[model samples]
Target: MHAGTTVELLCRLETEPTPDGGRAVVVVEVSDHHPARAVRARQASSADETRGHGLQLVGAVAESWGITYRRDLKTVWFRLLAGPHDRVYGPPARFSQDDPDLQRDLRAAELLAPAPVRRSPARRSDADWINHGALSFLAEASDLLSGQLDEEQVALLAAQLVVPRLADWCAVWLYDGGSRDSSGAPPRLARVWHSSEGRIDALRMALEKDPPVLPVPGPQRDGAGAAVPWPWPQEPSGYGPGGAALACRLLAGGRDQGALLIGRAGLMRFPDEVVGLIEDLTRRVARAVATARAYRNQERISQVLQRRLLPRGPATVPGLESSVVYEPREGAWAGGDFWDLFDAGDGRWCFALGDVCGSGPEAAAVTGLARPVLRLLARDGYGVGEVLDRLNKTMAREATDSVAAVAAAVAAAGPGPDAAVELRAEAEQTRFLSLLYGEIVPHADGTAGARCTLASAGHPLPLVLGAGGGVRVAAAPQMLLGVVEDTSYESESFDLAPGETLLCVTDGVTERRCGHRLFDDDDGLAGHLTACTGLGATAVAEHIRRAVHAFAATPPDDDLALLVLQATERR
Candidate 1:
């Protein structure tokens, strides 16, 4: 026998708890290289100290000993009774196939062995011994599970990783609920496959014909790391080990993602060592599957909420052309920046863009509230200044109510030393918005022209780009809305030439930081607008977005919103 033979024999050792201590079985498959043979230990000579002592010790301790071969696989098994019971049984006996009691024990031992694999006849180097190399198999499993982000993909990869390497067939079941382990719920079958397509189809047919081996009835252990006995045949119909399958739960962190079932043809049973290796492999698989599931869930939720908060598209406006481009900050569903264009009245249109104080759901909530309120106030024929004033008052009242709610909730829970501090912070959590609100009235002239009245509320002044390439700040910056109730705002009027454009933007564009310098202050945006003098509204908006992205050292740290309006030539 070669060195790999000893390793293979060790890998095939399995133990089961008997009524006494236990029964340890070692299975050595009969193959072309090794034929069926009988062995007799040489009698220890008077001078011989250790040559045959190995078998003598085995015979002395074992209450029973036997060898059995089924389906071309031979198993060598021995049973040792617990304590005083062993003394009553005497020494181990020779192998026997005709003894009814011994025959039944051997049959049961064969079923407990790991599923057998059909090894290739080709000779390989010591480094490659097929399934016998447990360490190498684990390394391969680790490499296969890395970098997979989808739970289903991870499960599929796990099934593929074990086949033709560890087992002939593999099935991965995963818990579908939030709980970590199977203590609360049963795992659902997630993926299954076989080394050969024929076997896969046969297994599928068999599964359809019979009930799956449900989880066995036993005391559910929280962290037991071994293969559970699943009462499923290793192969379909008259093939493989009959009704012998092993399953180990896959666990990572405190959660149990599910279990892995491994099966193969014939009477080959998995050893305790092999089961331990499988348990470790499943741990890695569980963590990867969990992470992938979490990320996908978050992404789906974010996409849904963001779609609701943003406008369907820029609202249609006649004679006046408009376009908007919004990019959220990384790692958030929605950012604070918002913009909309809506019909205010006969021959009048309202377009406003604003940014709330922060990012995420809190800011999104304020954005959600501010946009419609601005629309309602403007449609009711409120002037730009009056709109900002009313918005400030409304936000202030909302903030006061929120602070009161926080204080009450905290008080009900019983105040601690930090309670007063927490209350002060909540009270100081006043929500605010910076806005540029404008109303455009088109000229009755046959030529495409418009009169735009706009007010600035703690927002960047709108940029008026002339057809002649001159960039001018259109209105003086004023107090931002949602800060002080009585704060006043002023309006300014400007004419849009047939080819001129007005650009409204959130602070994400102006405050874009490269090192310590701002994008707008360094003439980055101004220079880009000058070069895009003759472009239409949509083209100019896209050009600015590209320019900002290219100029930034990193992705924009804030949300970006750009709204462009241009007076077009008559068609």
Candidate 2:
């Protein structure tokens, strides 16, 4: 009865006449194509946990059940008899242990176990434990399953949760994209667990040889009737001697992710209640699987986008030690902060650090456009100031087109008057940028220091740290890029003497928050750079980076980027 097993049910009610009163008999028969676990029990009760749970519940209440079988159908039947002499007046009091029905239930328990050990005294009252511990177990299972973002890890957790609680052994099979018939990909065994850990591998090998397959249009396709009896594994011997097992499809959001197969070492047939519990677990597992896959896919796409937007890394700037730190905030596909250092023609090296106004694909678009144009202009011998002027004109033109596009899309949706304001705000967000651009020329003799020319466009001013710990601003701030095409930019020039460092950063560092205080609230970054007078470029960058992180108990929400350029001694 693995997965696609067919089942049928029939009911019969009869009344027998007596001298004083009549007795009524109600019988139900459940038939299936294969031999079932409910029929093998000679006597069933609460202690007979291996005997099917449905039969145990029926046996607890019914006065007597008659065996009804035919050659054509494999079936089991339960009969309930009520005579006029028994409780003919009022309903039996409370359903506690003092009731007659419960007293009879105690006798049924005795039939299964002369000495029954109970997890709860209330459960010992009748066959109620069939539904007992189920809620608490599912809650714990959900807690364990939540926040899991790896499919294989979800499978492992599912197996561990079920073993010893719901089954003696458990196995999880995962499909790559869809089930075999749908995706043409066979399911892979993701995890196998057993109460006794030693038997897992052998049982897994056995199960793999003949894993249960649920194809299209089966009962597994729908949510109801998710669990079906599965044959016990025959591999490595002794598994099938006196055990029962089943496979339940793991489905969520109308997608089939995998299957959960569970086996009990000493059960006749899996109790229907237990099957229901496993079915619920399968649903939760499927959801966890879907969630994990979604997270992985987003991470992958972010990676691909990042590669397309940024270079492999910055290049070496000769005669000067250069170090950079870039940390994108977590859970973001792309960050606003970006930096590049590359060789320009004629002993000139070009470097720029810029921050887009926003994040994700929008920021990615601007980043993709800016870097190549900057590199092309610098290599063609454009000075830092001239490059900014030309890049600003280009950015302004792109911004106008972007705003027009957004307006068209928004207008096409036929929204109300507020749409105009929304369009303006969104248009303002694209292409607007804060940037610091610089060019360097070594002393014409490959010495320790170089002449630095730089400008800032509404960006944090660069700090110059001398070997003696004095800090000075390297450049003054100007209008931001992409804001106006008619604006002119100015550049500042200075000699980077040996052992002097130029520090540049995006807002992420200057605005890092600790309580109400910012990292650079009152020239704090300058003060920190003053403390690293003797450190190398990398050391200075890392020290300032660590200090910024330690300033706040909470991790920085904004993307962080810093570039350190120190004039070094010739090797």
Candidate 3:
């Protein structure tokens, strides 16, 4: 059935009802089948093996089956008796050798015996060996790739995994993303290695001295080839030639990220199966490399952008110590969370921690605008409430204009498939921010040595860790900014004696999740803060960061920013 379905034989099926059940029979006849040898039969080599087991299966499932042949035709037949009353031949003893009927039946059965079958070696398909080896290799490769995100490590792993397994020598080269050469110039060689550890140095030197052999554009444009033939021309003492080579294109996201070159010396030529296995390996490697590159690039850019948005260092103030920690979510392109500290002169220091409502470049733009504007207005002598009021008005105005612009663009684009999506997003136009801003004014107090004022705009209340290891939220009244024009905010004043600490963090800290439970406001953040009351500003900030991260089962889903301020001396 697996081979084909065309046949020249005739088949007949008959059935008859019985008192207990039913009886059925099937007969297949082949007439003058040119070569009688084609009709020979043999028992299956094993019970589990399917070849030559068709009659055996019928005999077991259907009560009886036999073959009879004539000079002009061969008829094969099978019968089934569904009733329990009938007992057919039970054992070999039941058919005595002395009986004439038994002898006649034995003679007839001998005519159906199969002639000697000429056994031939089974042909292996290209996928058989590849699937067996590739399954294990890919599993190991996946584990290796997951353990590291650096492209260099991935390339090194690829080279090492292929050597001694798929090749005697292997080398991996990656494109120099930062190369300043013209596009036509060859890609810079990033890695080169051979199977023998002792011969690695010599092989590397030869590779370095020779110009890179870029693959010619073949049927596949991305690139696939061995630049130089094996058997080192310069240093052939340790290794000899005649080794067949393979070049696999490292393609990721439809682009050629790199190439893997492998060589086998002597008689170990790459079969089609091995070549297919290498191709699959290269495909996985390319995807991993591409992902690693993209992640690294994003991290670099995120660091730069975040640094520019936040102050390089904490605000310097007399009798105060401050520390901050900011960690962006892994793989996130934009950091909506931001914090800043800058001295506003005259013994007053302004600091703020805020989170934009969204992420990506759009949220980054809003953050850039908000952080600097807050600092500028505070330095210009605006009170905490007044600064937020003005900032909210500015955000509201800009958001309105942005919506109008997007709407116009959508209308101009016409009613295409993408246009409706754009229109919907623009129509929603929800851009807002949760902020906690405050001005710390140094003053003397009898019980509390130093005093400061804090304010909020729909932000989490600050946690004040007392000198004696007490943690409680400092309450304040507020509304989220950028949602409405002319929004007003209320301030709360709290005094911190020496050794007391003020811990303020974005929602990314308290909202972190562990399974179904959240590191919530009442118990989670406050509980961690109580344990670090006497710690210095930097230690307290780091403690909170560690605690929140430990509580989350997975990596933080949003940006985390924390600001810690400690009263070191009396005003």
Candidate 4:
């Protein structure tokens, strides 16, 4: 989409033997960075009809057409019955606008295109009305499918998208291995939809006994735009008019994602245009299925790592109450942010709240190494500053190892096309950390109050809430960890007077934005805490969490976490 961007282009034409003349299938593929979506047909204003005629034009002339997507490539293909072989396709001897045949073809193209091609107001029905508005159906289908992240939801939506419109009933069968040919498992019937609600179960049960086995798209196989005839079920009365039934493979990312089946009771055979439309819908469904599967796999890993990183509950302090609120922003789990609270023995309790500079598996690796090392140092009797100083060294060492490993990988990639891209991607991921680490010691009475020692390293300063509703900063900020080695850190020491509260929050809370205004604009966090002076630690945590969410109409875009420590007398 930008100047100097390199994209591979490919074109292939294949001929298929047919009872009626020959058939030609043309496939065009191009490299793409973004996921595939339905072709968009924008509303036109003036008489000029060529402006936004993207895939709409293809939909007009092609007898059957569909789209397929791989990880880095997208293929849009169309099929048409071959004409007389002797017909010459050379350049016209003299081009003229007055040609009658040319004029006829132009009219046909216009008439075949969806209603928006001929009229400005083809918005005859609501977008959800299937098959009536072709443009709206495609645009809405893409919007709905592209946003789904569950495989089952994708299957359900596919079945509902076709039934009661193009067909009397539709059913979806998904391969657990994403390959119907897999030796491990068989295709599973995921969803079934029908115009009559009661027929859904009967249809599903009948279909389960006979799963369709379609050929994988290949040189010998028919084009992806084509569907094979499937047997009609007549076991139950009224199941079919014996009209027509067809099934197509849901193929994407170079494998069969699933199969789609649909049947109409009255039609002897579906029109080519209708078949092409269903083919396009199948591709979109396949792409959505692939995306949902990828996300589900990642979610499984993220939740597992997140559980290991965060504690179930903060350790109990003798004279102080502690509560924590942690929420990784939607889809940003696995090292976006982490917090820990544990007892280090010797009447000392250790607490930490931190954010990684990057995200994903790389950041998870850093956080994974950081959390356990923090516990090890605290248990070894390292004071607050001492623990941070040692952890910084360990993080620096790990960062060096990571950089070296990536450099080695780049070298192994050589000067090939992927080398530079790999290096740039690796360079953008950092191991630096912003952290708030502290030690808590209850007073000798074990209920009067506690002594607090804490340090902020390139992190938001902690706030101390006084008994009389006043607030102030607790620790001064310093350099971030994993960036520089042997950095001497300083900890602020203070008495946690009875009934006072300490609030330490990650940047997710302080930097929450609503337009140009931030949640912590003009000391807003302190102001919010000022109102929460007399509440318990849990209440203060909940109050602050709610305030963060209420600060903006949208949810926070970054991982949010906070720690609340309240000093109490033996309660």
Instruction: Choose the strongest candidate by lDDT.
Output: 4
Q: Is candidate 3 or candidate 4 better by TM-score?
A: 4
Query: In model 4, which range of ten residues has the least summed lDDT?
Result: 119-128
Which is better, 2 or 3, measured by lDDT? 2
lDDT of 1 by residue, 60-109 (tens): 34443333323333344444433443456766777777877775533322
Assess each prediction's global lDDT (C-alpha) against the native. 0.67, 0.75, 0.66, 0.75
User: Please, what are the lDDT tens digits per residue for candidate 4 over residues 1-571?
Assistant: 2223345667777787689956776655545444434434445335544443334455455554445444444445555445766799997687689977667535433554563453234322223233545665677678768878888989987886786446778988888864554435668899888765546667887888888777666755433635777777765543565677889888765567778999887667776766777888888998888778766655565567677787878888888888998888876756468899999999899899998887765566567778999999999998999999999998887764554453444343222213342434544446788999999888876559889999999899999999999998999989999878979999989999999999999999999999999999999999999999789999999999999999988878888899999998775
What are the per-residue Cα lDDT tens digits for candidate 3 across 13-126?
A: 666667975566555543333312333444434423434334334433443333443343334455543343366757546556688876553332243233112111222233
In the predicted model 4, the residue pairs found to clash are 447-569, 447-570
TM-score of each prediction: 0.61, 0.67, 0.60, 0.68
| Clashes within 3 Å, all models in order | 12, 0, 0, 2
Ranking by TM-score: 4, 2, 1, 3
Candidate 2 per-residue lDDT, tens place, 1-571, comes to 3224577888887786778767787777777664322334244334333433343444445544323323334455656664545556777656776777765544434443422232223123212444545776677667657757788888987986776556778889988754444466778888988755446667777878876676545555565427888876766352434488888877765557788888886678887788778888888888888677656655564466578766677778777899999999866777778899988979899889999887754566677678788899999888889999998998888855654553444342222223453445654677888899999898887767999999999899999999999999999989999998888999999999999999999999999998899999889999899889899999999999999999988888999999999998877
Name the runs in model 4 displaced over 4 angstroms: 1-140, 177-183, 217-226, 234-238, 266-271, 330-335, 359-363, 399-427, 444-447
Q: Which stretches in model 2 have alpha-carbon errors above 4 Å?
A: 1-127, 130-132, 177-183, 218-225, 235-240, 265-268, 307-313, 329-336, 357-369, 389-432, 443-449, 479-490, 553-555, 568-571
Best of the candidates, TM-score: 4
